[model samples]
Target: MEATPTRHPRRWLILVVLCLSTLVLIIDNMVLTVAVPTIAEDLNASAQDLQWVLESYMLVFAGLLLTAGSLSDKFGRRKMMIIGLSLFGAASLVAMEATSPGMLIAGRALMGVGGALVMPSTLSILITVFDEAERPKAIAAWSAVAMVGLVGGPVLGGALLAQFWWGVVFLINVPIALLAITAAMVLMPESKGPWRKADPVGMVLSVIGMSALVWTINELPKGGLSHHSTQLSLVITVAALIMFGIWETRSKSPMVPLAMFRDKVFTGASFSLVLLTLANGGLMLVLTQYVQFVLGYTPTETGLAFTPLAIATLLFNTLGASLIAKTGTRVMAVLGLLVIASGFVVLANMTTESGWGVLAGAMLLMGAGSGLAMPAAMAAMMGAIPDEHAGVGSALNDTIQQAGAALGVAILGAVLSSTFTRHMPADAPQMARHSIGDALAVSAQTKDSGLLDAARSAFTDAMSATFLVGAASVVGAAVLAAFLMKGKNSGPVPAESAVDPATEAESDAMLTSL
Candidate 1:
């Protein structure tokens, strides 16, 4: 038997650095969500405008992931990370000083661009830093921190908003970026891979396709299917995607190697991740509103309510890593999904007056389940691909995750909004008799406390219904784990030997040299 290599001592340090960086990115993401009302109040922006402020960042970030990954490989990972971090900082400043919604959105887009660079490079760095035997642990820690960032984004944002104005959230990134950049410079060594040239065409196609798809999803609520605007966007998006696939297939240096998905593990892992993300993203957004707007929790209270999720995520992340060695992939993935489904079911039953203890338990269970499932999914996906393509693999991971979150928000938001509108107080509905748009407008101006409570009831019902959908999604993922994610870590490594030794050594040194 091959002797297991000692895990690098610096592994923990690398994870910490990456975790901190990810925290900054995630905090930036939802910080704005908590601050949205404040921002709207301060900037005099409309609901639609605020939505764009958030969606634009995600749109640009998700759209550019492939290009960023390939470019990082071609130019240099460390250089790209530093550049991205710096840009992120600069963008934060822009966000901090924004005098208009358009300016804020532009800054957010720039932040997304920085995020695009940071996300994949961080993952690639982690993969090289730890050996296979040690990877699950490292990834678990990384994944847990990431999950905290995901859930805590709103919490942190809420906390910041409680004390400071909305700009403070953007300013918060400045200090974190300083730490990350400083540490990275002193610690992270230079690394590069074998891309003789960048695939500009492939990059363009990916951007176009992802942009169209996301835009289509975002527009669906406003337009629905019958709206000519929605139809036009959907048609254009589908056409763009078809062109993107054709371009990727033919490109000599494809951004996403079409062959990668040929492996069942790769396709299955990606597909499962997409579904998981969709449910997670959408549920979180709606839940925040439900807790705050409907349940009438203050932002700080909302943040505190989610502490269980962060703690549970951390615990499960560590636990899941430890279990992966013995439990194997199938058992771990299935177990995680099952647990997640249970959490959703629990959440489905949540009421405005739900007990803290019960709510905490549900959040903890969901966090644990998510922490368990994500690392396994990521490991399976990355494990199936070649090391040389780690950048691409990481990009694929983020791509699915971001896409899932966006899709989740789009689908669930539409459902929740529609349901709320339809089930609103009879008097309120009568008041909205002009048009759905007119009713929506009237609903916004509603101040009647009784009518508000009625509306809240409707929103709560819609949220519960959505949680059931999320539960169903998790169950579906579990079902897939049973059939598709067969075998232990026994699957053959895909064409990862495509990575050259010199390049591997350089990247490894980059990750571990400190």
Candidate 2:
């Protein structure tokens, strides 16, 4: 008889280690945002250069996630986690010592590779370590920590920046990573699904396809859809992804199970997550700049201003999983999306003179909505996957989220840029028309309040327009979730319907060689 699975005795401790690992990666991404101006001045970088510095990391991270997930499933999750931590630590050191933009960007890219390896392993291991009955709470806790990391990043970076150079932000990751690696080694159990052979062709195709797609999105703000390079990238992205789908469907040992998309619960949950990330990512990006440029808040104050959002997220994250037990995934998801939409509507009306209380209320609503919806959506997706395929499943989840966030920033940023440009005086300097930061700098140098006023007004209009789009998107997601996600009000997801035993066994056998 097959042995019955048992929960690890040290699972909670292992979770702490995993949370630390996650915090470092999440913080690394956001911390850089607060330091962008300092870094730009230090490196003599252009706006395009700054964009690449951010996008390079996200692109590489998204591209490698699927491969990393599959590899983790074949190898031991703990082993892969260790390897990722090591790489991340090394990259942090490199970033800390970098004196040039190129060197810093290179370090960030390496960090992305490490992050791709680390991210899915954490979720996969959590699924493996916890029994089904306890999984939701574990996921909720994990989600809570992840949210904290997201909101805390700017605050942490601001604190560091107040007393040190921008490099200190990158440097902070090194010791934390080392500690996580050590703790993981000592506390986490080694676990893997059946071995699988590496799919080199699939990996190459996915990387190329996703990289091209993201590159196209990133470049759209600068050159619009008509640029030759953007058009070429779009074509390449489409062709490569199409080829990847065909190959995966036909391959004897597919990297991803294309059949999973047929499940409405899975598809709905996944798509909702994509939309959620898209809206929130764009909201955060614009708001960060708004507080800094238009409102003239210092980095530290700006970070503190996000406290309401963070608190709301924490409270809802803790409560969401339990609420899911009562109301089911569908209700929680739809409700959360509706709440988020309401918050976006509130933000759409914000102006330069809007009080902090008004901003905080909008943020709190968005945070609470996201906290409730995201965990439920993630739970639905995770429950739909078989136990053995946890790594790749989690990877798919992460990939969609990262891609969505990248698209959000790209598309919304393009909107803001174009609208601001059109609204600026025709004689405004090129640099002033490039971005709010540039416009503010120009205004400061020229000592022109009229120029500053124009920039602020343009930005406010752009932000309002973007928030309306976000609200509409969230409402659409709510409608989709109401219809597409299948679940009855109550307890754990029905297992027989959730996992196909035959397919799971087949997948295990196919992955036996990696």
Candidate 3:
């Protein structure tokens, strides 16, 4: 006799735990931005060292996502989540105790590994626990909470730094992780996909390929395209990715199913997500520096400055779920991209003399657009996949965004560096030409007001150029989504692809028995 599936009485509570887990990760990312200047001052880090501090976490996070997803699917989501949280907490302690820049970077890289394990499982588990009808609302709530964390990071970091050492930011994660782990242990259920043989080769190739690609991008500004190391890195990156693609297509038990790319909605959604993240990643990093070094805002004041952006995101996220049901994913995504582009346009006109009011308006527009667009894009990508592939599907979604973010930081950082160098005064010190931080340091030491004015002007010009690039990319994505996602609306998963209630129930019985 077929057993009836047991419904989870505490599903909503489980979601709270999951969202808390996700929030810690999100907050960690943003907090680092606010803390970077202080870290550089304390650690005596150079421009390159600071870049690595930011990039190392993203590199490992993006590289390991697919393998982590496959592992979570093969073992169990709840088990993996616990393991991930434990590792993350341990890594946070390591970061807190780090005595040097390299040590901190290593700790952050370790945190990335834990993050890769946790991220996909959260979404996959959500998909499993909630039925199709409730999924969109659940996703919206998740996105909204994530935005809250994003906004809160600067504020939290500022507050912590005001009263404590820079390491306090890392320490904050330890307690949050402990709470998440404890709640998850009591409330979350273990679940896995159908058992399959492992694909170890695909995992190695993906990690190597992605790492090489990110490295090459990071080196491009320093070495240019023709440099020997950059050339070699590029070759390895291309070859490894090509091999990974071929292997996945031939493997009987592929870690990531390549067939999903055939769906226009999936492809469009993924592309949109990549572009959106790429634009935002670079823009946010640049803006943080601008607010602090250029506008002379203290860390606490900088955090307060982002309040408008957070409010805008919160307002729109609540409306996005219903908006998608009415206008469809295609229309919503395109419109959101357009709005984001408009925000970039507003920012492109900013000068060093621009007031906070001008910057706040840009943040508001960008936040509203992202809130409306991101959840809808995520829903389209998630909906197109079968429940059986949820772990890998969620991983793919995350992988693209991380890769885009890393690349965005690399490429856009390069743009800012080169532009600043070109516009800098010919007689500027070598240290001053390296970065805005360095420039400010040199100016302070030499008491060179002219050099300071030149640095500010050069950075403002570079900032404008970067915003234009972001705007162009977003506009291009808007056009592509329009063409590819035409006539498509966010809808329930097709019946054939959805999990059977009977099968789910039987699986629940088996798990309960175990």
Candidate 4:
């Protein structure tokens, strides 16, 4: 007779802690986006200084994720997470107290380090605590919490800004972090993979490669290959990543198992997610600007307007979780991507005369699709990894998704800027042709209704063009997912790699207890 698998009795409680850990990261970024104007004003920050404050965290976070994840598996996932929470909270305090842009940027970078440590551990720990039967539900709940944070962040930030200073946004994280840390220490069990030799060289190469890749992507919108620094960063990225791949394949004890990509399910899911996030990134980038600048909504109203997306996503996530087993991940993924493409097509038809109704309809469709697609795709990817490689596996997926989103932002930003400029009147001031913001500013200063109307119309046209590109990307993902899922085997992942029997038993017992 086969033995039954062990299930952690307190897995649901542990999941809440994990979700809390993830929520802080989402809320922080969203709130910071809303607070940018205020931050620039109070600090008297130059545009470059503000960009540093925004991008510095992402730069550090993306660069360190794989290393941190590997470290978490080598050490203890729960222990690393607690340390990350403490560091994140402390960094938030530092950022909140900073009087200079430089100080704030430094604090943000430190928070990125904490975020890198925290992110991978949460997913890895979830896989360990919950059996495969319950993993889908756990992931659904986790994804839903992220949607909540997405919807709530802007409204909360807007409210805070109305009553207090911009720094107050960072302060909100402290208490939440403290609660999560306390709960984590009391409730979560320590879990780690079997001991392995360190790969310092791999770590260094990964950090350099990922950071340089992000730098290249961020600069691509400005000058592409024309900028010498961008060209240099691109070269560094390609060289470092190629070397890292070659070294890992040859290493006696590799930091990451490149063989995961050999599984068609994992590879397919990875491609689907990259395309999904890429389009979604452009959606957020362009829609936020359209909502605020074109529709003349305040930040809080903009948050409220997005409720349709959040609500639809939350509902569909629950539905997808319940239905995924019956329909299979492939079907769910392809169907969801198709629905999202439909949403993009709807958005592509939007005109200046179109009201909030068109926007809400598009968001609902996209949200519903997201609710179905993301969990299914992620579940497929994570399902292919052995428990020992859980942390690094998730971190690898995170890195890919991050790069896709960044690339999408760069691509769509360039399209929007260039398209808007091309559509502007020949007689318009040069500054007015740069962006809708500049155009509106000029119109306000000169009292030109013609300029104001022209700017709004031009922005809507540019936004339409961007959404069409987004639509094409999503449609491509759907077709690619269908093709890739054909005739693929998905046998169970292999067991943990040579963990000591006694240690595994002790960890299992601790995890099962309340």
Which candidate achieves the best TM-score against the true structure? 4
Each candidate structure's TM-score, on Cα atoms with residue i matched to residue i, is 0.88, 0.91, 0.88, 0.94
Residue 68 in candidate 1 has what lDDT? 88
Model 1 agreement with the true structure over 109-175: per-residue lDDT tens digits: 9999999999988887778776766677778888877777766787778677778888998999999
Task: Give the root-mean-square deviation of each candidate in angstroms.
Answer: 7.2, 6.7, 7.7, 7.3
Q: How many clashes in each candidate?
A: 2, 6, 1, 0
Q: How many backbone clashes does candidate 2 have?
A: 6
How well is each residue in 1-514 modelled by candidate 2, as lDDT tens digits? 6765666899888888888888899888879888999999998988878977888888898888988988888888889989998999999899888888899889989998999899999999988887665666778788878878788888898888889999998898999999999999888888887766677888889999988888887787777877898899999999999999999898877778778888888888888888878888698889989998988888888888888888898888778877765556666778788889999999989998887998999989988997788878888788787777888898999988888887888877877777878888888889998888899999999999988998998899889998888888888887677667764311244343332445334323432321
Q: Which lDDT value does model 4 have at 106?
A: 98
> Which ten-residue region of model 1 has the weakest summed lDDT?
490-499
List model 3 lDDT by residue over 201-231, tens digit each: 9999989988887788778777688799899
Better of 2 and 4 by TM-score: 4
- Point out the worst 10-residue segment of candidate 3 by lDDT: 487-496
Native-to-model Cα distance after best TM-score fit, residue 147 in candidate 4, in Å = 1.8
Candidate 4 Cα RMSD (Å):
7.3
lDDT, candidate 4, 19-124, per-residue tens: 9999998899999988999899999999999999999999999999999888988998998899899999999999999899999999999999999999999999
For candidate 1, the C-alpha RMSD (Å) to the true structure equals 7.2
After TM-score superposition, what is the CA distance of residue 208 in candidate 2 from its true location, in Å?
0.8
Ranking by lDDT: 4, 3, 2, 1
Model 2: lDDT to the true structure = 0.83
